[model samples]
Target: MRTKIILTATVLIGGAAFAIAQTSHTGHSDGMDHSAHQQEQAMTGAALSEPGQGAFAALSELVRVLEADPNTDWAQVDLAGLRAHLVDMDRLVMDAVVIETDLPDGISAIATGDADTIATLRRMVPAHAAQLARDDRWTVDATETNDGIELRVTSEIPAVVARIKGLGFFGLMASQDHHREHHFMMAQGKDAHGH
Candidate 1:
């Protein structure tokens, strides 16, 4: 019964979000801006949620979350930063090139791309490497090379080593679940990477 209720709620919310997208999406050319806030205001039947695109959906969700919070300082809110970060994420996943070297216990790679992708990679990999380093299961290192960013990840446990090797650099980057919190903070004009 509880499962059915949860599933029903999910379906209803999804339907509402779709209706909102069909009604509201204008096919903007660039990143999401303050228009998301306007979209938030334009909601109908409390059904308007999640814009058509992934980044827009994420931004809109945060806008809703922040707006609902009692202490949110609108003056300090910086959805632009979050939008920029989301663009960086797209670049990292879609554009960056990973040159992998398989290791006995793990893997190493020099992640490279065009100028913009390289810049995003340099900023992102090291920060995430720092995050990965804190985990006892793996030893992670990221260093800047002339052409790209070099990532080395290894593990002490045999099972973990196999997992690390399988994950490789890109998968390793996707391992830690920090992007959501970082997005919220970035949207609030704060640097989660402190960079």
Candidate 2:
């Protein structure tokens, strides 16, 4: 009876260990599959941001049209020019420099610089104004300063400009968040082995 009880206990323990091992193995396999899918998406440019999606979709359609008919009208298939303009717009947004200042009512953000910067800011103002109009929490005023253009941004809440920095035409519409994550991960001083 003592030997039979010992064998039964051993079998139970071994079964539990096998179950735990199988669970961990299945989890690891699912993780690998998910990682591969994400890698595939990144490889295929499926991770484009909003602006990138617009540009990519336009270009893709243009390619399809051209492929269907090599003699397609050059005017109709001029998406490359449109793509170039989109790139320029993106560059203007990414290169914009915003300076924030404290105000009695709210925060003030000044986007000013050289002539070229002023022109870019001016071009972006209508789009920003449209966005601000949609959001009733903020108000904006624009004026030409001696150096460049000053945009006085006010909101009911504090740090409004900083909060809304990623929304308007002046904001970066591309998928640069991964770069920021990589930089943060590197700054954390943790290696691949989690050291």
TM-score versus the correct structure, for each prediction: 0.74, 0.41
Summing lDDT over every window of 10 consecutive residues in candidate 2, give the lowest-scoring window: 186-195
lDDT of 2 by residue, 10-112 (tens): 9999999999998867765444665675788889989643333754654565456456776555454444444544454554566666675656544455666
Candidate 1: residue 172 Cα off by (Å): 0.8
Tell me how candidate 1 scores on lDDT. 0.86
Predicted model with the maximum lDDT: 1
lDDT value, residue 95 of candidate 1: 98
Q: Cα lDDT of all candidates, in order?
A: 0.86, 0.53
Q: List ranges where model 1 is wrong by over 4 Å.
A: 1-50
lDDT of 1 by residue, 1-195 (tens): 999999999999999999999766664544557667677777743555557889889998999999899999899899987888889888999999998998887889889999999999988899999988888988888999998899999887999899888888778989889889888888888879853
CA deviation > 4 Å runs, candidate 2: 1-81, 157-195
Most TM-score-accurate candidate: 1
Return model 1's CA RMSD, one decimal.
10.5
Per-model root-mean-square deviation over C-alphas: 10.5, 15.4
Error of 2 at 110 (Å): 1.8
Which clashing pairs does model 2 show?
none
